[model samples]
Target: MIIDIIGDIHGYADKLIGLLTQLGYQHNGQCFMPPKGHRALFIGDLIDRGPQQIKTLDIVFAMLDADVADAVMGNHEYNALAFATLDPEHAENYLREHNETHTRQHEAFLAEVPFGSERHHYWLKRFCEIPLWLETDSACFVHACWDVDSMAILKPLLTRDNCLTPQALTLTSKKHTPMFDALERVLKGVETPLPKGIVMVDKEGTTRSRVRVRWWLDDLDNRPIREIARAPHSAIAQIPLDTKAEPIDFTLKTDKPIFVGHYWLTGTPTPLSTQVVCTDYSAAVDSGYLTCYQLDTECPLPLSPNNFVQYRHT
Candidate 1:
């Protein structure tokens, strides 16, 4: 089957529809129909960070109901669930604390789908239907890093279809547990500690001592932190190397192709490695493009850049 692995939508409905149309999906007053023998696979983060939140959800659900599309749960979607779920131990608080930072990051989605409204509850139910990861005979689709170790730990806790069970959700919502760590690693990717006394400030001005790493790199253990980091090299190029750093052994060992999103990658879309691809191209930001990696599931490994399709707008 031909699968179109779509990146994070982040409420950019217009860009999403543009990419869909370009991929030959025709809208029939409701859902978009994919070309024969083709289907769309979303890597999640379908809501928040953009203007058309409701429209974007509607489009995706319509296609899902039409059986032309499937999706995995993203970190944002997981956060939404936690935000809505009241803490059993402390009823006044939520599973996701309503602190300033969390609220600010979630305000856009909450603004569109008011908390406790029928629409909000409905979407949350739909979100529950989304699995945490999907695996076919030849490929795997996840929101972020597809760490085999994490998946093994998470397997039984998840539902039969790999979705979060209520118990699993609760376990994952709380920090410090094996479940939480596994969920975080898969949904948010892996991070490595920076050298002592070195830190980098993110766009939001938050100082970070650890950096997200390219987990798919076979030689990640041998690379410099700047080169191994997922962020721009120039951002951390000046930091002194941590010569005593412990080796990081988080590389993917599979020969089967894996597709993931969640990283706000810039520039032209390309296969991250011979067997791995990151579909996210910062679609939620201005000057960013909505992208997808078109794949024939039966095709050989070592994906090519030519298959990267995008909806670009200045």
Candidate 2:
């Protein structure tokens, strides 16, 4: 079977439609139909941070209903579920705090689907339906890093199809728990604390003491911080790692090729490593693109740069 691995859309419906058409999908009266023998696998983050939040979901929902596409739950989607769910112990609070930062980050989605509205509830259910990760015989697809340990921890907690259950959600919602940390790594990628007293301003303008690292790379001890971390700013990316910083002992252990999104990668779309490819290209920004990696299951391995398809901005 052939699969097109799509990246984080972040509510760019026009780019999604454009990328679909570029991939040879036809727009029938109902929805976009995949090319013969091809299916689209979205890496998620379908809502928030851009215009046309509901419209983006409408297209994805239509494709899913038609069985032409499948999706994994992005960090944003999981956050939405938490925001909508009330904490059973505290009737006044939600699983996700309604703080200024979270509200600002999620305001676009909440604006379109107001709290307690039927539409809001509808999307929340859909979010739960999206699996945390998808695995086929030849490859794996997830929103972020696909850690073996984290997957093992979450396997029994998730449903047979790998979607989240209400109990699983509640269990994973409690901060600082093993389950919570596992979920965070899977959805948001692996992060390592920077050297003491060192901080970096992220693309979102938030100061972060910990930086997301490329989990697929091994022997990072020899690599510079610019090569090991996903710091968006060049100045921050160049900082030397302090000797006191903890070493990253984990690395990708899978033989199967993995496809992931969530990192706002820039430049020409390419394979992150021989065993993995990141499809996200910062599509939510004005100059960014929506990307897809064309994969043929019959010969899936050692992903190449030639198969990347980027949305052409007209």
Candidate 3:
């Protein structure tokens, strides 16, 4: 089968339409359908961070309903569910606290869906239906890191379709639990603690003590922090190489290709490794592009830059 593994749309409908058209998918009044029996595999984050959130949802859900696409839930979708769901234990509070930080992160989505509208609740339920990962004989797909240990821990908790059950969702929301940790690693990727007393401001201007690591690489402990980090800022390079942080051992070697999105990578799209490809190019940003990897079951999994198709947001 020919699968177009697409990255985070983040509510960019025009770009999504353009990319679909570029990939030879024609809108048949209700949903977009690809020629030549191609299918789109979305790596979630369908809402938030851009204009036209409802339109984005309309297109993606239409495709899904039409059996033209499959998807895994992204962190943004998970967060939306948490923010809207009330805590069973503490009935007054939500699963995710509605503070300034969380609100800011969700503002774009709320602007379109509102807080407690029917549309918001409807999408929340739809988010729950999305699986956390996908696997086939030829390849694997996840929104972020595919840590073997985390997947093992999560497998029993998921439904037959690989989605989190209501019970699993409640359990995973608690901090410092095994379920929480596993969910974090899969949806958000692995992070390493910065050198003692070191802190860096992220792109969002939030000071963070941990830095996102390139968990797919081997020998991460021996590598310098700057080289293995997914988005190493200038301030991080200044941290001494001998800072003595233990390497996180999350790499899962596999023969099949793995595709993921959520890192918000920039520049020309390319494979992260021979077996791993990241299609996200920060599509919600002004200079970002909605990226997709064209995969053919007949071909080997090692991706080429030529297979990447994108529609840059002007």
RMSD of each: 1.7, 1.7, 1.5
Show how many residue pairs clash in every candidate, following the order shown: 0, 0, 0
List model 3 lDDT by residue over 99-184, tens digit each: 88889999999998989999888888888889999998888899998877898888899998889787778778898999999999
Model 2: how far residue 170 lies from native, Å: 1.7
Q: Candidates 2 and 3: which is better by lDDT?
A: 2
Q: Rank the candidates by TM-score, best first.
A: 3, 2, 1
**CA shift of 173, model 3, Å:** 1.4
Candidate 2's clash total is 0
Worst 10 residues of 2 by lDDT: 236-245
lDDT of each: 0.88, 0.88, 0.87
Candidate 1 per-residue lDDT, tens place, 153-175, comes to 99998889998877788878888
Give a tens-digit lDDT track for model 2, residues 46-90. Answer: 999988999999999999999999999999999999988888888
Clashing pairs in 3: none
All candidates: TM-score: 0.95, 0.95, 0.96
